[model samples]
Target chain A: MTNADTLGALLLENERTRPTKPAIREKDLGIWRTYDWAEYTQNVRDFAMGLAKRGFGAGDKLCVAGNNRPRLYWAELAAISLGGTAVPVYQDAIATELQYVLNNADVKVIVAEDQEQVDKVLSLRDGLTGLEYLVYDDSRGMAELEDDAAVLSFEEVQADGVEYGRANPTAFADAVAKVKSTDIALMAYTSGTTGNPKGVMLSHGNMVRTCRTFLENEDVRESDDLFSYLPLAWVGEAIYSTTVSLMSGCSCNCPEGPETFRRDGRELGATGFVAAPRSLEMVLSEIQVKANDASGIKRWVFNTFRDVAVDIENRKAEGLPISLGAKLKRAIGEILVYGPIRDQYAFRRARWVYVGGAPLGPDSFRFFRAMGINLKQVYGSTEVSGLVTLQSDEMASPDHVGKPCPGIEVRIDDNGEVLIKSEGVFQGSLKMAGSALATLGSWKAPDS
Target chain B: MPAASTAGEVTLSVSGVSKYFGGVRAVDNVSVDIPKGSIFSIIGPNGAGKTSLVNMISGFYTPNTGSIIFQGKDITALRPNERAERGIARTFQNIALFAGMNVLENLMLGRHIHMKSNLLKACLYWGPNQREEVRHRARCEEIIDFLKLNDLRKQSTGALAYGFQKRVELGRALALEPDLLLLDEPMAGMNSEEKEDMARYILDVNEELGTTIILIEHDMGVVMDISTRIAVLDQGTKIAEGTPAEVQADPAVIAAYLGTSH
Candidate 1:
């Protein structure tokens, strides 16, 4: 067993160091409900002890399918802390698609969000012989579920842990102590757009090293906040929300739902952000639509400054020095248009914004930067533990994905395929490579 | 619904409370104990006297019989504004936001009781009134953030969407920072999404703010999802009172609402 520290251990260390600090917040009913590190750690311990009492130990796979919720994150840490591997499945997966992942992983326990997901698992319950428990976060409408023994509410699991803790006083600590760094921590399934999804096995060390390295390269502080509406199953979210945020003791905010992201984001004034290219496009389109509908003078002011912002962004990207007059014009543009737009989009406090998961359009990329948001492109895959190349602020062009992150090595072969070697690399899928494609020197400009 | 845990201290109690509107007995003899910091839902079909019962507790109507107790103190004779002063606030089934006022202004009006500025000092717009105005506005802004109404803060309440107008009414009630909040069909006329949003905000108010909520909602799904205890009112009589799960399974509740076998 590798003695290297696990992500769960690092989280415990963070708890010890900053127990009262805000760890995460979620928009509930209309309020940003906060959870401190001490509460977060206790929740994880409760889940761990509860699952442990249920005979979930070494080699057990706990399948978690849900939206971004704090409990889901705690479940992952709890599973990993006791030598169990967490498998986060996409919440939107259809029954047939979900069946494949569950059966493939041979999941022992399932922690689903609500009745919709519970129904999916229950429909396939007969086929999944290995499945033991179905723990649902939202127990609404679940009383009608036929299999009483097979299902338990999320609160019941935590209560079980509390009972277990009282019965065997040292049980929680003993279970946590049994976890080793080499243990498989998580199995994230890639979104199978064209074919069957493959599971990328990330160990505790891999996750901790990658997230720590990313933290080192970036200016992540405890004061930094993240609005995490992304899917927890996605590698990016796992890295940012579950791993790095814990590593840095920063607060992660979750929107009430998909529809409330813009409002929640503005309310949070989040400092760091990670999202897909599609979301960026949506924001761009939303801005354009609203700006177009404005009165004549307002539209004119926005359009004129928008041009100035574009010019400033172009100059910065080209590494050309800005003229005194251009700088003055950009400063005025910032006050007139850019600043308010950023505030409206909840980018007012954003120090770093990452766009990944699919290639982003250059126009959308430049648009955010033009609004004075420190937008950057992140290039990596699930096999790399979600960190490879991060565009630095100095290498501010949208055309080229910047230098590789700290402790990561990147190489290009004669075939023009990108090969990466890093501590963050998954234990499996060692030969994972992406073709450079026809856009070699023009690599920076993603497909619009 | 099974019985709610008798753990929470009873914050409000209505013993044999009944309201009569002229010849019609809008509410028959009813008794309910709302536990502190729990969502107590009053649900029934229309004309079931659910609203009438709520009106009695919120001081909108005088109960013709029996008495009401809050924190063991009898408040049966208190007026509506007087009840609000004693930490009771309410929202109407139909939105009651000031039509001429913007969202922020409407919310500020909710803080009127908290403001102690006399007209003599207020005429100069300086001194205690100025400080009080700033303080009240700041409190309203906090409610605005809590309700995610930053985008619509300056818009007139009448010009807003039905969903947003409902939200604004909720915001105004929240501005009171009440200990006991009476919501009258808060989710009525709202779409599913709007209902969900309202339900979440209500939950937040109950949990985060530690406010005891007496909710009147017809949306069974939302009521079941949020309410710690539920009372089924049918034909001006209390049919069932218990937790959501228990009430959902109750034969009497099913007969009255979901329909009888006959």
Candidate 2:
């Protein structure tokens, strides 16, 4: 149980314990679609069999193109279940941007949504030596297209599996066992806003260890719902929604499209939140601006209480223990200030707020904490499958990004750059390892 | 050779093809005739259900009530890929290329229907099925040469410039070798130079392959230049349909715009 490296094994164990518990909640057509742990396990197994029926084997690379959704997660699970690597790309990326990733990873298979994605893959069908198949999720506008050989719908693949599994029922489990921790689980290309993107290779071990370490420090229950908004290609969200959701017995929720989180997060009441600092900043800023427009007594009380709490947190951050007199004053401020504040944001029982992707300001950190939110910073990389080290709830700091995570050896380099090495540090890209990665400080160049 | 359906003699027909979201018609009671090899254009302003109309025609959406007949077959209930299989293909309003995949892979997705073996055999890459795979690869290379996308053959679809992305999208649509090609705002968000390139590619597709084109375009200049016949849609309803000159002179189309202008 402690040394589980394979994702397929980890999921099987959890399914046994909480078979009926919800595992995935994907928003489809303005509704949240729930898949329980048992159902999800079957889905992964069936999808893996389908992949094998579609000619996918151990060590295959599958490019998944879609927003944060359950099917996208299923694609990852299914791909992994068959000992294949899943490469998730941002849905908004243009055809040109995907060209490098497709070429470099030599993505043999693509699982995509809608005509938009299908068309893009079609555009680049010229020189791709490895790419041979496209499995689309949506049949919209695509019913006229036949799945003869190189392309298929996700459902068609599953149907093929019905007969395929009958022919070789144990093939899926065998492929799962054949998957070594050293084999790549996912390849995330760094957003190449600047130059060609570089693919960051993350192994099964790197991903599994990250999820385990984060869960060991914080308790996330089966009841907790995590809203997935960020691109799955991004490490922060993938860890929280994909890896962490698998490690901790929790359900990961994906909104319908963009801004879906904002429109529906209140309804979801996500008990655990993992988002970038930008999202946190945006929400807080909006709340602050709206509060400013509030009339009379409400505005006045909010201001006065917030002012007192901010001052107290600032003093504490500066290493000052509140005097007995100050502690009493702080308790009064907590009742007046923090309680109502937390209530407004629906953080009543919110267990964790993880902010990463960029440095979170000290002021924002203190403000969130003052409101009883255990907002912590997690420092990570896509290559590390999300976190290398994360701030604990007790010792969460804005200025410093907490201690080294379990199983990792961390050191500050000569150039004052943070260096992390562990069983979790991915073996790097399968194509052009070492050279493809350019160490730009702690951040590596993304595969273009 | 697959028999070529003759030009501009009504190869495609839309009989009241419509769509609704929570019972509000994005496209309502819209029908048109597209002659084989004719360049037909649908013109409208933003939120006038222009995109929705194209979506229905491209098989992205099913008409709640109506039939879309393409190449003498009822395709109203057909899915996007099914439509693609019936020689009906489309480009996007926003270029939807698989950005992480390479240029060649994008083109290969277009030939997805052309492959001979089952997915299982293709994945294994063996024997007779492998030869079929090689044959398709060679065919895709030809499409790449025709589009002049060979230079960026191995480039990531995500990293390509905007114009090239749009070009690659068009190339993908052309790969289907459609009897009727639907182009949704193909020149939107492009620089003048890029638009010129797209216009040329559209002309080539229509002229060389004798493919019927149903295009939704906001750019009047490009629409007027390329379309043999034009249809005007305003507020999800078809206002007029005729030759380019006839549509340009129609009073109802002008009144629809002028009435809304107030």
Q: Model 2's lDDT to the true fold? A: 0.77
i-RMSD of model 2 (Å, 1 decimal)? 16.5
Error of 2 at A94 (Å): 1.8
Interface RMSD of 1: 8.8
TM-scores of the candidates in the order shown: 0.67, 0.64
> lDDT tens digits, residues A301-355, model 2?
7787777777777777788866786567668767876776676665666788888
By lDDT, the best candidate is: 1
Q: Against the true structure, whose TM-score is highest? A: 1
Error of 1 at A39 (Å): 1.7
- The deviation in Å at residue B221 for candidate 1 is 18
lDDT of 1 by residue, B17-85 (tens): 888878888888999999878899999889999888988888889999999998888999999888888
lDDT of 2 at A398: 92
DockQ, Cα level, model 1: 0.06
Q: Candidate 2: where are CA atoms >4 Å away? A: A1-3, A144-149, A191-195, A321-346, A433-448, B1-262
